[model samples]
Target: MSWWGKVAGGAFGFMLGGPLGALLGAVLGHSLDKGMKGMEGAEELGPGDRERVQTAFFTTVFSVMGRIAKADGQVSKDEIALAETVMREMDLNVEMRNTAINLFNQGKADDFPLDEVLDQFRRECHRRNTLIQMFIEIQIQAAYADGRMDGAEEQSLLHICRRLGVPEFAFRRLEKMIRAERHYAGAGRGRAAPPPSKPTLNDAYAILNVNADATDAEVKKAYRRLMSQHHPDKLVAKGLPEEMMKMATQKTHEIRQAYEQVKSARGI
Candidate 1:
């Protein structure tokens, strides 16, 4: 089966509802197959297993997307209609359709704190960079579902992408797509510039606890400190759990990148 089918099937078996179960399943299933492979021989997973992971990943991402669609005060029927259109395009089955409804309902819940909801997704996404990218892609899809991408949706997606460590170049494509959709909607928009470097090299440096003018020694110190913090194993042990190690791994990548950038700029 396809990714959505696999996730919905695995999730439908749960009594607690599909979103939470699918999210957990997607994390564990992907973690077991992707990150933890070295524990044994690391053979590739079969197609069935891969399908399960993809579905889980897609469902989790869209579930969060559903939440974000409703974040700006009200969930318009137009948005709901758009969401269904995307689902149909993806060829989701009855169970998946029901699951998506449940997830959308979950997003509409009164106590739903979007940041925490996104945080949970961030951790799960941090476990796999590709999955993180996919999650953002789905959010963009949901934002464009209503035949236009609003500024509010774009801003929310930016925040989500930043928290999930989505690279700026990847997001640029999204910006273009959104702008194009806006124009098509007769919203009267200009082309989107490249996303600003709001959370890139500088943010990475901040994560390392260093300033722009730090001495080499200070930079090294910050690098080591962040290395310790960003270490995948350390993050896994510190309640981030191994399923979400992608975030830690991304942090480590950012730390190394920051060090290199600093070294290059300083002529060290």
Candidate 2:
């Protein structure tokens, strides 16, 4: 599978990792049960449950991407073309791509119930932040796919950055590093090794943008404020290119998880 396929598949695995993580794992025996059924491992799928999962997965993933692409003021043909390339690279049939595009368009529309879709996705996927982040990273890659990223795209992604409980400055710094490396590779420049430790919990407080000794209220406030920025619907409204909704879902999960972690750690 391609890197994009791995990401999508990982999203499902992460989803099952939440509440149903344990049971599903023992039943399926595999981390990602893309084609596997419940414990019995039947080839046949009950139409309703399968359809529901498919809808949730499709809605959430495309919605996130749509939100990212529109992060900038207007959607450009370049972005659209890049999206098509992604679809093609994934080997999604024309029908599947069309469906995805239609969903993407719906997500970008003014009145699409983004919050509702998110809610449904959360309910179905059980809201795993790791899964969400997988989606978000894909959108981030999409936005930076072309050599240059637009101001609107950056702003759009920043809004998502906030929602995911990710610090804008850190993400921007990471983005800068990613772009620089890509540039160097394009220009055949010598490359330096990256820091061994990518972003992790060691920077949790920084990711939350809170003081080490932040009060409970302060922590909640920061989490809420950060999440509000990455709210999937808000990103779409802000004209973030639609491709980054994947990031939005992950951000929402991250926000929730961060809030929980803070509450637990502070015994709030």
Candidate 3:
């Protein structure tokens, strides 16, 4: 059965006990089983509970998204629309979509425990840095959904990175890359494009997260590593939701485009 199947059947919270479990229970209108309350789960997900980390990821994404949307003191139409767009892109089922919306609302609450939630989520992933990086990227994407990030949103994003153990420079790099991606998506090859902001050699470097002075070989290594991390099939095998394949595929496209641009510029 899928993770949602187990969760909806009221069997998820017991095995996946943690802050995530509690959030899921509250959203579902029940108390998570306390058999493992206040205790830590295994560093690695075992065979029987392979769905546990996936559940953690889903719970964190929606709830943290809610808080990020409201970080600027008000939830704008653009932010809300981004949430809906993500749901639509994921092609979520009726049940899953409704649950995600509720989780978003929960995150927007003033009393949302941001630090605790991040701590538990990080633990749940058990040093799976690839998954953690994806989580941060999603939040950054949401914060700038309105085309610009307000000061409060930026601070909130930085705080999220601090709590999640992501570096400040890494966050800044992603910010630039996502901004570039905005134009890159619209400026398809041989199309009437926006200003020549994206696809700039600098932007390409940001997307690949490499220094301008890096050697050609280093650039190729970064490209390959990022592509591997965002590979749709591989991510799904590692417990990323099937509904998220669209996003994973989009990321790979971005990485590939950035790589091509770099290769052309360097005559690689």
Candidate 4:
């Protein structure tokens, strides 16, 4: 059975015991454990469990996303649409989609345990740095869903980064990359797509996180590194769900466009 099967069937509950399990159990409308609801100490999860990690990834992502959306004290229509768009892109089935929606709503609650969830999530995927980065990227994209990062939203994101051990500098680069993706897709300024030149040389540079002055070799190196990190095959092997291949491919596609633009500009 797939990880989702195990998770949805509640077969994976024990290994995910703690807030994550409790969260999933809650959204699934089944009690994983009476004790799980108030459980903390997700620190006990180790990095060696691949099935466990995959289960945790799907569970934490939607829930934390809700937390971020509510950071500004309200969830916008666009923000809700953005979450739905992700669900569509992933091609989730009816049951899975409903669970994801419940998780998102769960995240918006007043007493959501953001820190405990992050701590456990970090540990579950400790060996998969790229996987963790992918999760952060999703959150950043959501924060930018309405085409602007609200002040409270930024603060919420930064706190997420700190809890996940992501540095401020790294967060800055990830933000630029997500913005570049919007430009590459001709998403003029918001979720609404508008036709434009689509990713000027400057946006291309931002996508790759390199400046125009960088050596051609450096540019190529960055491209290769990003492609390798975001590659769907590699990510799946590292514990990402196969359902996420479309999302991962989009990321690599954007990077490729950025790299080609940079190369073309330099006459490489």
- Using lDDT as the measure, name the better of candidate 1 and candidate 3: 3
Error of 1 at 51 (Å): 5.1
Query: How many pairs in model 3 have backbone atoms within 3 A of each other, for residues 3 or more apart or on separate chains, i.e. clashes?
Result: 0
The regions of model 3 sitting more than 4 angstroms off are: 30-48, 187-198
Model 4 whole-model lDDT (C-alpha atoms): 0.83
> On residues 91-112, what C-alpha lDDT tens digit does candidate 3 reach at each position?
8999889989999999999999
TM-score order, best first, reads 4, 3, 1, 2
Off by over 4 Å in 2: 1-55, 119-124, 164-170, 173-268
Cα miss at 67, model 4 (Å)? Answer: 0.8
* 1-268 per-residue lDDT for model 4 (tens digits): 8888776665665448767877876877644554354546543755676778778888888999999899999998878877888888889999989988999999999999999999988877875789989999999888877878889999999999998888999999998888878877666333643344567899999988899899999999989999999999999888887788899998999899989988898999
Can you write out model 2's per-residue Cα lDDT over 109-153, one digit (the tens) per residue? 666554455544555534444344444555665676544677877
Model 1 ranges with Cα > 4 A deviation: 1-19, 22-52, 113-128, 178-268
lDDT tens digits, residue span 30-114, model 1: 5323333233321222322333343345445556766767767677666676566555544555756665666666666666455
| Candidate 3 worst ten-residue window by lDDT | 187-196
Backbone clashes, each candidate? 4, 31, 0, 0
Superposed Cα deviation of residue 170, candidate 3 (Å): 2.0
lDDT of each: 0.52, 0.52, 0.80, 0.83
RMSD of each: 12.7, 14.4, 4.1, 2.7
For candidate 2, the TM-score is 0.44
> In model 4, what are the clashing residue pairs, if there are any?
none
Which number leads on lDDT? 4
